[model samples]
Target: MIATPYLLYLGHSNDEIGIKTSRGLAVFRPDICVGEFRHDDCGLTLGLPRLDFAAARDAGARTLVLGIANAGGRLGNDLVEDALAAMEAGLDIASGLHQRLKDEPRLVAAAARLGRTLHDVRDPRPDIPVGTGRRRAGKRLLTVGTDCSVGKMYTTLCLARALQARGVKADFRATGQTGILIAGDGVPLDAVVADFISGAIEQISPDRTDGGWDLIEGQGSLFHPSFAGVSTGLLHGAQPDALVLCHDPMRRTMRGLPHYQPPRLDDCLEANLRAARLTNPQVRAVGIALNTSAMDAAQATDLCARTADMFGLPCSDPYRMGVDAMVDLLLAMDAPAATETI
Candidate 1:
């Protein structure tokens, strides 16, 4: 069970992923959040209740979550000190940083002295073997995005629910902490050795020897210089039979990096599929998952229509438009196996 009286400490985590994490607290419903966080006053504005660290402790918040993304595993000294203080206060800490908390000797010793647990969310499982995706026996689907934080996880979840509604066995294979929290299991793809990334994916989605659907959550992007390796590794690792490209209509620039612009949706889709074909030439893109929450209804519909036209694939804002058409395509692809007599 997840320990609660949760207090998420956001140390100036104002970037796209951090902001989303703050707002997503409502979905997780932590008792209190601690920090001076900020974001676009957009609809994703964090409505999660906030409290000072002192007040949070007074109110009995037992666990402190590092609610920020330490991209490239970089953490500030000040943040480290703050975390040690929290551990001294008897708050078990949970972190998703690529840098494992247990590796920090000072923090590890502090937590041990305080008898508090440190959960490194990105820690990889033991004995992951090299991937032989050929051994899999499922109609796998992966959601690739134009860039990071473009709603890949949301699209995967939407597709999973849709497939389940159609009486198809669907599984969500998570690649990060947030997705792990939602699905209750997954490998943190970026944490795995570069050589074993695909092996990690293979382990996560073992051969059922049956053609059910597995919606593996895509990460990073082939276009993102920062995490392009992770994106490519997941693509080759998942070896998906069908792919869904996810994009955000309102995000004009790459998250975190202001000087950078996101790659075009069409170009991103082409690049991802081309890379995937290197391992499995038979991979086909079945749909596009568009994030349209920041746009008006007319704008969202127009973008979806144009995206569908360009890709010649079913396109929908999975959250607003529903994933029916996308799931319909996958269900059809797996028809032969799905209809087999037991």
Candidate 2:
């Protein structure tokens, strides 16, 4: 099923992950959400009609999703207790953390005793082979970001929605937990072995005769010291024909890691293209998706215009712009005559 209701946990100290999941759930439409989560640090809608574990269990929420994406995968004291309590209530647990819930003895025992399942979203299949790019077929696009948490997943989701609204067939491929939860089914690229990362994408989006579009959600940035390798792997693995570069105007340094400065947008875009073309010779960047939530309307508009002019491609905030500027480019490259106007 495309839509499934579950209790999403947002109690982690990293409120940013909670906020991202909260926004994602707005599109996913969970049955009920709990905790204080918001995009901008300012105003947050406290699910004050809050539903605790007991309340959620009574309401028949059999599945509990740990939606927070913290830096260290260690289950902290706060989340540990909450997860146990939910498990005690006989609710199955789903987690997207690098630290697998199944590996935790308490949760594992609790699940066994209760006969419930622990869904570790990051668990990758063994023996996943290397990618050949020969599996690539149909229309495909990827959302590459300038830095971490710069709206690659959000941009990809919005692009999928926009494509569908235009009566085009498209699918949003998830490479992270929040995106996987929203997408219902997708492989977590980071969980797979380094050698098979691209292979995972190849498996997720093999050749398609239906002429459908695959919006591959990018993981890390090519400039990020810790995650640069992953970005290169995804680009080479997916072999997308089109690409969208995502950025946040407010971000100066890479998230959490300040010593490393974020690269200029043009440099990031150029590098991503250069790396991607190694896999698919026809690959090209179609547009830019800017995240300007911190900026006021006037500032956002001005920055977007400048970015568009600088890149000589359509620039938009997927939340506000809906990828309208680049959809025409994708459609033209995918199907010229049919999508000439739209």
Indicate which candidate wins on TM-score: 2
> Candidate 2 on 35-117: residue-level lDDT in tens?
32222323444353346777777766666777766668667766667788887876777777778887788888887888878
Per-candidate TM equals: 0.73, 0.84
Candidate 1 Cα RMSD after full superposition onto the native fold (Å): 5.5
Off by over 4 Å in 1: 1-19, 28-64, 69-92, 104-107, 110-116, 165-167, 209-211, 250-267, 278-281, 335-342
Query: Over the full model, what C-alpha lDDT does candidate 2 score relative to the true structure?
Result: 0.77
Candidates in order have lDDT scores of 0.75, 0.77
RMSD of model 2, in Å? 4.9
Error of 1 at 114 (Å): 6.4
TM-score of 2: 0.84
